[model samples]
Target: MPAYVGAVQVINVSSSGVFHIGDVIQIRPISNTKTFSGAGSFNTGDGLAIYNQYSATNTLDNDGIDQGINFNL
Candidate 1:
């Protein structure tokens, strides 16, 4: 079966330090019921930015699904 692209939510952010450019990171879902379909990336040009480069083909069947990405910095 094809995987689904579930919903994404930002749970927290780093309070200290500044993120820089050319940074890559992988983020997993916060909820145990949900899973990340693929890897993700991050880029910080002048500010912190997160990108979900991986394409999700599947989705959660029920409610309370949480997904997120990380910063390489």
Candidate 2:
């Protein structure tokens, strides 16, 4: 099995983007950054709120699933 495309038009690819017209085995996109705020303090929260701060490291991964069909092809 394979893929076929007639025509396509890609305008732009952002800082974290992937552009492919044909078959792709795997795509791993990662974004890591550091933030610097000059606010008075980090004392801001609501009833339904969470912590907000600059993370020293990004421990986020795109490992949501591991199926058999993906490798079958």
- Work out the TM-score per prediction: 0.15, 0.45
lDDT of 2 by residue, 1-73 (tens): 5777887888999876878776777886555454554433465667645454754544455786534343332
Q: Could you report the Cα RMSD, in angstroms, for every candidate shown?
A: 20.9, 10.8
Identify the candidate with maximal TM-score: 2
For model 1, give the RMSD to the true fold: 20.9
lDDT digits (tens) for residues 1-73 of candidate 1: 3445566566665654333334346433332233445444233376655666656655556666445434322
For model 1, what is the alpha-carbon lDDT of residue 52? 61
Q: Give the TM-score of candidate 1.
A: 0.15
Q: What is the lDDT of candidate 2?
A: 0.60
> Clashing pairs in model 2?
none
Best by lDDT: 2
Off by more than 4 A, model 2: 40-73
Q: Which ten residues in a row have the lowest lDDT in candidate 2?
A: 64-73
